[model samples]
Target chain A: MARLKIESLRKSFAATTAVDDFSLDVGDGELVCLLGPSGSGKSTILRMIGGFEQPTSGMIRIDGQDVTRLSPERRPTGMVFQSHALWSHMNVFNNIAFGLKLRSLSRGEIQRKVDQALELVGLAGYGHRQTFQLSGGQQQRVALARSLVLEPKILLLDEPFASLDQHLRERLREEVRDIQQRLGITTLFVTHGQDEALAMADRIVVLRNGQCEQVDAPDVLYRNPQTEFVAGFIGQMNFLSANVEGGRFRHPDFTLDVEVQDGPAVLALRPEALRLEPSDSPDAAGVTRATDFGSHIMVDVELRDGARLKVMTAPDARWQKGQTVRLAASAFALYRQNRLLARGGLPVETVEGRSRHALA
Target chain B: MIRSYSSTSGRFDWMGLAFAILLVIVIAVPLLVVFTWAFTEVWRYPSVIPQKFGLRFWDQTLSRADVWEALFISLRLSATVTALSALICLPAAYAFARMKFPGRDLFFLSFLASHAFPKFGLLVAIAAIFLQLNLIATFWGVVLIQLVGTLMLMIWIPVAAFQAVDRRMEEAARDVGAGPLRVFWSITLPQAGPTIFAAVLLTFVSTFYETEGAWLIGAPQIRTMPVLMINFINNQVVVQYGAVLSVILWVPSFIALIFARRVIGTGSFAKGFGA
Candidate 1:
């Protein structure tokens, strides 16, 4: 397995940059997902890596060698497309053995490898069936087997489970992750599906408008997003405008203390992070519980300046929507995640190159 | 929803039915007469049906050296012509149908525009060129002329057919690691099956019955079915209405048309071909 490094990779169409000047390293045997919404440059970056599209400007390195101009056949990377793309004319056995045959492997060896790949994908007995005769999931397995048979240094998947239903998607995702981990193959999975990325990636690179907004483990990304974009994108986030006053911040109806000064100039909290309590309780503290939204309770209360605010609460707790309550995120944590997740919003820490600590 | 009639149209007339039936009889009368005359026996002036049914004419044509030679030449010529023309047309038709070259629409329109004129109109000019090239009276010469006149017809019909196929097939093929030629071979050519088949059949029929090109550039010894049929009518004193020439010339084509018909009716032939 090989590590992949991209430096200032950029791809642009006529009036838009599908991928901005972005860079990230995928270590050996590490699975990194380029996760974003549609048009966020996730697939474009994947295509650039797979040699389908030429990057406008960038250096792509595999292990340590630059592969900016190598053809897909010459590349040591295997890619699986969202459409499955199994050859309809070939039978199950031939489809898996295609790459090995191309490399002029001996017939017996090719057959062995094909059979092994098929068995790995759990389609061992479908050797003679035509690709078109297989079901959607079966065809997907065939494609996976085909790529896996090559045993490249790295594997790239572009929304591999998008076409499947929810149940099938879940199963296939687990299968792909399991196969990838078992082989210890470095993989780059591109998808607009955040759930897919978060569920499987060793580190999730959440992209926005062609630039990387944040990259970290799933829990870190969800608990503390780096940028305002990441904060809004990862999951449900409720943003409230507030003005900082020395060590404290004042909202319309709530006054909270910030340990630091100005950053993104906006305060944001996830629905699940904010706890709720009864507004009229004599000992009301932290966020008060409010509206019952079935899955989770939504709390409505007043800010310091009397403006209304809503936060999420646990589903088991009883809450009402219009009641007033206090809100505190001390337990929610400020910089518990990466520095990007911190409110100071400065370059508090850098993962690549040398670390530059903020002199708070 | 407005008030619309379910059982009846706004205007329905018994007179329309009578008129339509009358139209069918009028149109079918001439074809029925040709069939009647084709089956009839020898007659002094006129005869509605054959005096007696016999295989004399059939045997006569079957034994004739010239008729057999014509049959051999026609079958060989048509087979080669259809195959060669399809090879040239299929790729061009596919390109026209699926891609956007600089002058694609213009070139396709020009090819279709040639269909407006009868094949005979270009005979004089083509003959002059053929004579200058000293190609007249050669089998290859006649075939070449037929290829030119029928190429556009072969290409256009199939181009339209390819255009009607699902556009995703090509994109999918390419994404699956197939290059341009591979995609065409596996996905494109097969998916355009029905239209291509119809084109091949139409091209074969047209070239088989071709008189102008074969007559202009072909040798007397290399006459095709229609060319020989014309010669018989023009040169012979006693009109040869025997079944010999007719049965020998038309039967083979009839059999061929049946094979072509299967391809035209349904596109099941495309199954193994498309990846």
Candidate 2:
């Protein structure tokens, strides 16, 4: 295994930059995911590291050796492309053994390694089958086996499961993760699916507009996003525009104590972090809609000031539509100009008394 | 049920029958006349068929030394011209198909322009240049002139073939430790093999039958079969000699057509041109 370090890497096509000043450090045997939507430069970064694309600036070092100027064949990196580009002229065995044959390995050795790689991808006796004879999922397995047989120091996957069905994508991602952990090869996976990144990557790098938005572990990224884009992109977040003065967040319906300057701020709260209770006070919000998700009910509440919020609560008849419900946030993040300023919990104050709702 | 299906499907097709008759009158009648003349000892005007049928002329023409020399020269020139065209044009076709250099489209258009005009006029101009360069009446002169005809077939068809090769497959080969040359051999060439083979066969057959260039450049010394056939038609009194030469010249192209059918079925041949 090798540790890959990319320092200030940048790529530009004639008039536009695809990736800009992107730097990443992946430890030995760690699978780091570059997660973003389309045109986010995630795939460009992976291609630069795989030597398929030359960076306009900066350096790529693998195990303390500079490899920025190396061609794809000279680099110790193998990539599984998005289209599973197996050669149609070759059968499964030849497709996987092509690189080994180029290295001039003996026939017996190449056969043994190809068989072993096929078995590792769960296709033990499919060597003689033609590549076109395989299904979409099976073709991807052959593509994976083709790259893995080279025994490269680094493995790169560019949305390899983007063409498969939902179940197949899930099963293949799990299998790929299992094989990567078993082989302990340093891998960089590029995906637009957040769930895939969360399930397969040791750490996720969220990118936006050719720049790094946030990089953190899965649960940490979901629970504590550092920016408003990350907060909204990672999960379902309710954003409310409010004003802050004298350390008090002044919403149209209610107010809360905050630790920011005297200016307008944005509050981002996750659906499950807010609590709902039936009430008749002027500060209460009317239930617009409610959906029961078997384990919990997702209630959409619209405040009197025309602001809407989604609150997740247990199965309660009082959380239905037309019910005036008082809202309380167990946790919230305050943002100014799309940057997170502070995060805290708020207590719900009712006619009876002030009570803090602790959510699991 | 099978009998009824056949009867309905095979109902009399007058259009197809008319086309078949037209084809026979246009193509088969001349061939029938040639074959009959090659075997006839005597045939005269005002008669539908030959008065006497024999192989006397065939025996006489087969014994001629010029016939054998012309056949050998035709085969040798076709082979050399085909090989040289492939050597020079395949790489240029690939560069035109895949590379992004300045004036590439203009260069490609120029290759297409080789076939745009009356070829005899062009050959006369080229002959003037060949005469000045001491290339007149030389074997290499005929080869050079024949190479011009092969350009359109050699460059255009294979350019389309190479353009149709999936670039992702080449990148996959490179990603798996194959260098640029290795990727081309393993992936790109094999995918484009059938179409390129079809182009080579076309170049060979066309060069074999090429008359103007061989007649103008290799006269009096290096005579190909088509050049000899033209000479026999112009100078010889007997008709059987030209008939035998025509029959002999049709053999290579007929065989080449059969081979072309197998290499690229009619569908893909059309697709190669479509691109």
Candidate 3:
């Protein structure tokens, strides 16, 4: 059982700190993805775990052993790089056999293990093919075989799918996930692409500016981002700046009783959660000319006071440019904080649980 | 068919052909003349063709101690110098090419600075230093001085060669559980083999034919080939000059030249020197 616990890890490159007070735990058989943009320290944390880099301050314990100061070869871990660093001079078989050779395994044993690895990556009978002669996808398999042949306790992957084409990326992602599950290895994967992280990882650790913005299972992180950064980074978030006072939330020209702050607050509304209707009571308004973009229709509605509210309608709807309409977002209960980004006991009481009577 | 014919149609220029022929002749004629004269019995001046061709130069030159000793010393000294220089510079070259450390560029620039002085200007001082060290007539002195002087060229060539091996390859090897030494041996050194071979060959050839370094600081007991040739020519012995050069020199140089094409390359040299 390779249970990894990283405690307050920090890494600095001279004056530039790449990872700051980062901490996480990966239970046995968990596949965790460190998701972030470039320079977000996602890759750096993976490197530190892989033993390729030393954290400025942290404790890395694997199955209760501190392996932070160990070299990569000494640590019970295997890593695949972004470029699929296969040995060009060696054939597929020999490349994968390198680790076995280092371990002083018998030639027969090495051959058996190598063949098993090759077939595992679906490159059976390709043992003699040189790495350069293989296609990009095949070369990626060779790289995978090279690492899987060792079957280390923890597997670290650093953007391995970034170079693969879209079709191959999809296929290989499934293959990798299947293989990881089959081996039951604890894994740490790093990627800047959210879709890849969402598709492959059991849990996603969203990072920004050398700090952990949030760490939760994919659905939780996506649905309940505790901070604005997490909400914005995960996918599309339609932002509306408003104020909360007198136990009520105030949108421009509208107000409703809600349990929230008494000062400035930003509401991140997903476009799909917004609703539209004809303004029979004259409170709702939407647009006409800015309609019908792709499968959805984007309408801009102007209030009598000239404040504009935008809403997306289905493509089948017949909303045109000159029409004025009613617009209202879903209830306040529809949105939630992204807890991965929550800083403290920054007290987040649920909307229904609190005594605010209506919505915020 | 129309597209194929159009693609096949081309232009020709006679002036370009004539100029190319002229350039080839201008380059090839001198080398041809040298080889032809070395093979013929035409030791006298002003002869378009030899009146006779014989093994007279080879047979006579084989008996001369000075010629044999000089050629042997030149070959041995060059081999020793080249080997020593490569051994000393290999690690330094790898560092300069791939590693990042404090003041690397400044330290590398210091190695190149020794070549700033003209060889002619340093003849007297080199001679003095050799005398002080009692290396003025020692074979080790020739090898030592030649090694230091040739190191810049040798190190720079391999440095550029190693730099061309792509740092990503090294990083890959390291990621795959290879240590620093293993990375160099398996990745960097293999990639740089051809270029390093060429560098060593060039250094050996240059040191073998070096006239100034041998004359200024070499021991009379360990005479280099060029010094031997010059002394033979200065002795007013036409037959001896022919014998010493043709038999004692041309064969080995000709053999080396035949294999020189292996070391020299065209576009692929970009990977050697690193664009």
Candidate 4:
């Protein structure tokens, strides 16, 4: 049985719908990420699960118990806020011990639990330090420890690393994932950052306009996004308008044979899926604007018709500015409007032999 | 270079020094005169200073049965008013700071409007209402009137203080299994400590110095220190006794100001509300 099940949850504030028809089931010990840009209702879903918000029309079941109308304090979920929300007046030890104390645990048990939580978050001896005296990363750990000490039925983190610097954020992302896995706690993490979601989550739920756009594993979300929005959002993609007639796909600069239905479609090409080679043909002429980032190079090509295509290549690859280059895709996803048509590695003959033959 | 330029300019600010000294003296001279008269045995208008100084007036005022009775009544009334206003305002302030209800801004503006209205103008109408309610000359009557007059400060200060408390802190507490009241006591109240302390001090001192409501609402049957002080001033022969009463009233307020100085100096209160 699913540890937590949310069915058709909707929340409307005044005339605006903040979260609409949201539904998901979190399995036992699964860490799911709600990923979206700002104002996408991901945080709203987390708040609803945490019982901070009341869904307009839906039911939430945790461990087979209805919890939709329950107040936050009555629920069995723990949440770490984006601000880390450490009690400024309380020391780290007291902040971590707060939930245990509320549960009316024995003094000795509370102490043991708090100490274990501190160790789990790697802040074992810093319990007595004032929360404000700690650095941003330490404060975030205290927030995590505070929630984890409760041994709640579920853990909800609302962009917990948003306040930290990039370096600290990356480190804590791994630490939190490790801790969550060790405890095997059912967890829901909310973040607008795609990298954070991809790095930490076992599954990603993409939200847009108060609804779930797609829910899949990180690799699946990146490789085979079912929608154009998901394709663009999860990773970088170059969208090119093309037409398929009798299994031949034709674009302004290139043509190839593909097993696609005869119609107009948009091809979503990942930058890494394409390559650039110097060309003398006027039709294949393009200028190279390459940006080197040590590990890889991102080359942006401006075609003669004013279309910009990006291609990612190895750091050793060299291309001069204003050089004419032909573009070829090793793989791409085809979409008709917002609907997906085909996706995968292109046939070698279709990419090289057919393109060269068509150009000649 | 800028530091040297500022330092060089700072040396010739004689006019600024003069204005500060004048400001202090202007404020201190009245209290000094009141203190001097409270202990003066004999003085004439043309003397410019007292010819004789003793504690005769102070002793006479302290020995009076009515004077001590008035002092006790005044202390009790102010204390009750301060407590009652806090009980009413703390929740109202929290609501104004944290919750969004219909007409919230209008409700808050009403408090500001009540504070802006001159207290003296409302005294007569308030007295009439108290008289009809059979609350005239009652201790509770004076307490009620003082609560109304001083509630604006009690509420406004804490509203800002509570707003300064991050909303996420309260939510964190709730997520940690704390109920609403527990979250308030453990998080909200402690975060708002300095402001609440300042509010109590302001409310207590204001109520302690209130004369209009005390005199108008609790005159003969309930004689507060201010009412007695007014009585002493009304009598030409015993006019100096008013100075003794003024010193008596000033003592608690002075102590409160000293305490407030420490709290406000912590710099938390100076950040202002909604900061």
DockQ, all candidates in order: 0.16, 0.65, 0.32, 0.78
TM, every model = 0.75, 0.83, 0.83, 0.88
> Which regions of candidate 4 are displaced past 4 Å?
A242-250, A256-264, A280-288, A347-360, B1-22, B29-57, B95-113, B230-244, B264-275
True-vs-predicted CA distance for residue A7, candidate 1, Å: 2.1
Sorted by lDDT (best first), the order is 2, 4, 3, 1
Docking class of 3: acceptable
Q: DockQ score for model 3, please? A: 0.32
Ranked by DockQ, the better of candidates 3 and 4 is: 4
- Model 4 interface CAPRI class: medium
Error of 3 at B188 (Å): 3.9
Q: Taking the tens digit of each residue's C-alpha lDDT, what string does model 1 give over B14-69?
A: 56667767776897675555444445446455855656555555555467687768
Whole-model alpha-carbon lDDT for candidate 3: 0.75
Q: Write the per-residue lDDT of candidate 4 for residues A1-29, one digit (tens) a residue.
A: 13999999999999999998989989999
lDDT of each: 0.72, 0.89, 0.75, 0.86
Clashing pairs in 2: none
Residue range A1-360, candidate 3, lDDT tens digits: 589999999999988999999999999999999999899999899889877789999999999999999877677888888888776767788888877887889999999999999989999999988888899889888887888888888888889989989999999999999999998999999998898999999999999989998889999887777678888788666655556677555565344555654766655655555566554443334354565688897766565446555567788777766554554555322123432211211111112112222233
Residue ranges of candidate 2 with Cα displaced over 4 Å: A238-257, A262-266, A269-331, A347-360, B1-63, B116-118, B231-244, B265-271
Where is model 3 chain A poorest over a 10-residue stretch in terms of lDDT?
A: A341-350
**What is the TM-score, restricted to chain A, for candidate 4?**
0.93
The model with the greatest lDDT is: 2
